[model samples]
Target chain A: MRAPLAERVGNYLLLIVFGLFALGPIVTILVAALGPDDGGSGSSGFGNFGKAWEIGHFGSYLRTSVAVSVSVVVVSVLLSVLSGYAFGTMRFRGAGVLFYLFLVGIMMPTEAIIVPLYFDLRTLGLTDTFWAIALPQVAQSVAFGTFWMRAYFRSSSRSLVEAARLDGAGPWRTLWQVLVPPARPALVTLIVLVFMWTWNEFLIPLVMVTSESLRTAPLGLAFFSGQYTSGFTLLAAGAVIVGTPVVLVYAFLQRHFIAGMLEGAVRE
Target chain B: MSSPPGEPRKVGYLYILPALLVYGAFLLYPLVRAVHLSLFEWNGITLGKFVGLSNYADVVADAGLRAAFGHALVLIVFYSVLPVVIGLALASVLQRAKVRGLGFFRTVVFLPQVIAMVVVAVSWRHIYAPDGPLNDVLRAVGLDSVARGWLGDYTFALPAVGVIGTWFETGLVTVLLLAGMARIPRERYEAARLDGAGAFAEFFAVVLPAVRGEIAVAVTLTVIAALRTFDLVYVTTSGGPGTSTSVPSYEVYHRAFELGQVGSAAAIGVCLTVLIFVITLGVNRLADRSTA
Candidate 1:
């Protein structure tokens, strides 16, 4: 019933090699951040963090990232749940066509839309502003969120929504009171996903915001590396600073993240 | 779960309006508008000229742009093809092995997926630097002649960058294939064994045919990453040395933002979008036919 011993050993060997490939860069960076001063390549203790923080201007980038990601999550979650509720629970004349239209939104990469969007935002005088960065991400997240939640609502317990309706509750009340509370896991997964995507997003902020102060974490890190090309220790510390929040969140909620990704792939 | 409301009414429409508006204005409109822009010549600050089909021609005719597309295709070799093959190999063994610490292995391997590409690019840039660990290993192992500044060298730059894509993607492909492999019936493997199949024979006859959907998904995602990669190139090489690693997305960025070639960028964007659409659709269709 089991694989042969040699085969088992071979699998372990493959896993070990893969583990090193994946974790090696991360460990190297962490060591260069916290390990002993190998001359300028690394500095002992946490001084690199402080120095990278100041040199990279991470304080402003962090704020911009927080502001943009939170707004994206909140707006995306609200709009998606509402829309998903309709798409799932109600029938309409153009539902199928509209659903595919959103699917177009899902399939359309940022590369495809970003050019016209830049000019469009420029005409609206919003380029170089945070709204330029935040709005498009909200749109991207909502596209996925709507599809994801609609699927959830369709499969979830119908009795709850029916009971609320029978009790003369309005649609809004039914959605918020009867459904939203129980939909915490789906919403959390969506929020975490939107956060990571928005946080890691590079091109939009790169294209939209020319203002140094408005840079998000990843964009700021790119600029930081460009400026401190030779300062391996500082750059490594900066890389950690930019990547750590998402990694920590993934560490904590990896189960949910993995589940969402798998299920979402089916949606795709 | 519920039947259509007795009549579709204001509420259904109202609930969807906000999401549709954002998606419409930002995603849908821009896509359509981008296609529109591809047909004309207009700088962001200028009165436009109408130039139909020229930019698309340039996408093909311009040596640099064509090279960029070529680089993306080359990346597909490293990013998509190799990873899927490697993933299948890993999945085959792990499926048979009943490996311990599989969760830990899975998490660590998928680490690249979780990290930002910019961070991945920066870290690898250092690793590929002259005195970095990779070259150190090369020298220590008595292969010093093969090691150099990977991201800077013309000959090795594209492959070096592709290797990063490989590293990032191999984990994802492995995990996805493993997910598909788990659903395979035990009897199938037993059947292969009964047929006097070797490992290669079993893999080709049974395992390969079984995980078509996973392969489809993995290829689509990795191919898209290869074609559309931006952050990695931007941070690591900036399409470097002399355009050795420029992919279309980077060309789109460079033209629009840096060179002020708005129409050309839009044209390339439309072309890249079509390429992605056609290829991914073809992949999915092929996958479905085989599996079904």
Candidate 2:
């Protein structure tokens, strides 16, 4: 049923207000990025993007971000699927304890672990390396992904698993050939979230990497802004450069993103 | 779904072993080590003497540390309280009036969440500059006296930082509430209307009770965000303007890396963790009680 015209106008007005509030800063930065560099060196329009890319050394940073995000997503998604499948389908000894251990990883904040983690990794001569940045995030993502995919697995079709087993399919065959195809939505959600977290992670890369070449996009953007404090146009362009990849992925997969978030809220 | 023929009861352990090992080494081990290190007085490079909770004592007695925790509490207002209220109001309005382009609106609002916090900080830092758009607008409207460098002002730095949190979080909370509100069966809204319920009354009788779970989730998430806020604070103010914006997480980094106070940093980290747990549990319990 439609509301009265007065109420409808109010609704539209409120929505516009909120929409502007959310998109204003983003648009402001984008606009500034297109403007001429404040230092009178870089060209106007999209030329600023190229200038920022070179000056900020975003090529190297983006490469590292891609490497870290891809590695984390691949490893964590695989691990989460295996563990979630086991937990959702099996009843084994110590399952509860092991799952709760993962839960602690999920709930434990990174600040609490980073100090000792740095010291530990340093002792092992792993600090300032790719593994130091990627591995911890892999573990962190798996902790959440296991919980998410387990919920999907738990509510999945039991008859399908039974049917696969009756057909002489082993656990591996059942998971890959029978169940995973139907679990595409859940997997997509997990992939998107893990990728976003790994890409946007600033703290781990900040604390772990001292090498300029190993810096991720967000860390590079931070340092660039710090050094080029006077060049607003370049800084805005750098911000856009760092932010665009995830935004593109999000725009394409927004359904999975929103669904995963709402599902998390409902589960809570 | 019974075990396959000849399958052992412990076969599940094989699948979980790799994940469990990594998680234990990277997350769990470090957490326990943080706890242990919190109990000692060490510069993180030498043999440590046991302090036996004196670090915890410093967490209590140290004025700067006390103020950092207090700043986190203050941030909860802008981060959690304000956003939840705004979300509920927005969701309730939209629930009462079915608006077109709802999808477009939701997508636009949720965009900030996808951006990196460092980028968000940079954009807002430009906006909050002394001669920035905010001050420019203020001068244009003859409110010039109200304008200042928001993140640099001693009085306004924390609130300026908090407002950024508000901007970042409202979208998540609103989207969650909207999803929750949408699930209320139309028949219930009609039933409330049939009982002579106005918008406020209908919301109180129906929409409010229905979305308690989402509200709880939003609160929990935002409170956690506020407490664990390091990226935004680091990039924006770096706890500047004379520790006015210093938070526990920022302290966790600065004390350990800059000040060589590894013991105190660990102690602060442990305290922050305990605070998160207690507050999360409290919110969940309150949500449970209200819903029940």
Candidate 3:
């Protein structure tokens, strides 16, 4: 059906306005990052990126961020896949209660638990260790990840599971040979989403790891801005450095990224 | 030909054990301890006398805490309501028109969601600076009197920061709405059009009702994001300018680590958790009932 001419014009105009509103901050930041900087003058050129790199120690921060995010993603995904299979396909006593407990983990916010988490970590003498950040995040990730993978498994065709079982395949063998391959899309989606979330997470690292050397990229950026409060250009440059990779990922994997988010949102 | 169901069931229990143990150690233990701590007074290194109900009392009585919650509500307006409205409107438009460069437009809009919040916060802090682009535009338009320190001034700081939250979030909401729109069967709209419905009428009659679940999901997520408004505030304001932009999460941070009021901080955390849980449950129930 053809839209009326007036409606078409109005829709295009609305889209343009919304597009600009969405893009305005990013464009403004890019321009500001490029502008010349004095104590109060406007920022200019690529100089700020260099200055930000040097001043923020962005190189070291980026390395730490990459290491932490990758580790979290790998560990979280592996554990989630194992547990998701169990929860989804297999029947067990107490499974319903155990799953409900995991659901409770979903509602518990970081703020609600972080104070005690801090004390817990402190007691274990792992306050500033990478594990302090990674372990809790992995736990949090498992709650959602297992849920995600379970949904994927439940929705998966039962014929394959039955066929594998008929071929004398055990639960573990079927999961490895039959289920895992078909579940790859969901698993990939989970990995990317988890990586993006863990990489961008701030509060966990801020509270759990006080050592400057152990700071993730987001924490480092916060500290960098605080330490160099007056340097807008440097801040903008640092922002770009930290923000670009995820933006690039979203650009490329727009479909998967979006599907992952929607699945998480609508599933539970 | 079925195997005994009980054998596989036993294996399933064993399979879930590792995840359950990890969850028990990290999430459940900490949450229980947090609730327990909220009932007493203790600094990290020292155990003080029991202060039952006083921590809760302090959270309620504190002027700053009240202001912070108010600020969080303001953020909901900016972050949750505004984004949903704008995103829904845009989704409506995109659904109606065959726009050029649709994919590019979608990608650009959704870019902010993938970017770190700290980066977005820092970038916007510059934009809100006294001599930044915002003030520059204000001056250029002969509205010099209106321009002030956006992040530094107490009056504008909270709202200014809240607007950044809006900017960061609108894209994700748009994508979610768009996905919902995509799922709406085209035949329903065709049927509506055949019945002589206008664009607005068809939207209300068909598209809106179908996407109710997505809208609920969007609102729930956005509200939680608004309530947990910390990263941007931390990076940009640090609850400064007389704590104008402090939210509960930020206050919890300050109390727990900065002031060493671990027990009180735990109380605040508990309050925040309960508040969020109740609100989300209410929202979900309302959404379920309305849609049902």
**Best-matching candidate per DockQ:** 1
Clashing pairs in 1: none
Query: What tens-digit string does per-residue lDDT give for candidate 1 at A1-116?
Result: 67777766777788898889888988988887775544364445698888788878998998999899889989998999999999888788888788878776666678888999
Interface root-mean-square deviation, each candidate? 2.3, 3.1, 3.3
Error of 3 at A230 (Å): 5.1
Predicted structure 1, TM vs. truth:
0.96
Ranking by DockQ: 1, 2, 3
Number of residue pairs clashing in candidate 3, backbone atoms closer than 3 angstroms, sequence gap of 3 or more or interchain: 7
Q: Candidate 2's residue-wise lDDT over B122-164, tens digit each?
A: 9999999998898999999999899999999999999999999
List, residue by residue over B1-292, the lDDT tens digit for candidate 1. 2353333556788999999999888888999999888888887788878898899999889999989999999999999999998999888888777789988887888878889999998889889999998999999999989989998999999999999999989998998898889999999999999999988999898888999888998998889889888899998899988888899999899988888889999998888888888877888899888877
Cα error of candidate 3 at position A88, Å: 0.3
Residue by residue across A1-268, what tens digits does model 2's lDDT show?
6678887888899999999999989999999999878878748899998988888899999999999999999999999999898888877866777777777676678999999999989999999999999999998998998888777887898888889989999888998999799999899999998998899999999999999999999999999989986679989999999999989999999988888766754443
Best by lDDT: 2
Docking class of 2: medium
Give me the iRMSD of candidate 2, please: 3.1
**Residue B157 error for model 3, in Å?**
1.3
Q: Which lDDT tens digits does candidate 3 get at residues B1-292?
A: 1221223567787777777777788889999999889888887788666888888998879888888888889999998999999888888778768666777778878777788889888778778889888899999999999998898997889889889878878988888888789888879988998999997898899988988888888888888889898888888888979888889999889988989888888998898888877877888788799987
lDDT of each: 0.87, 0.90, 0.83
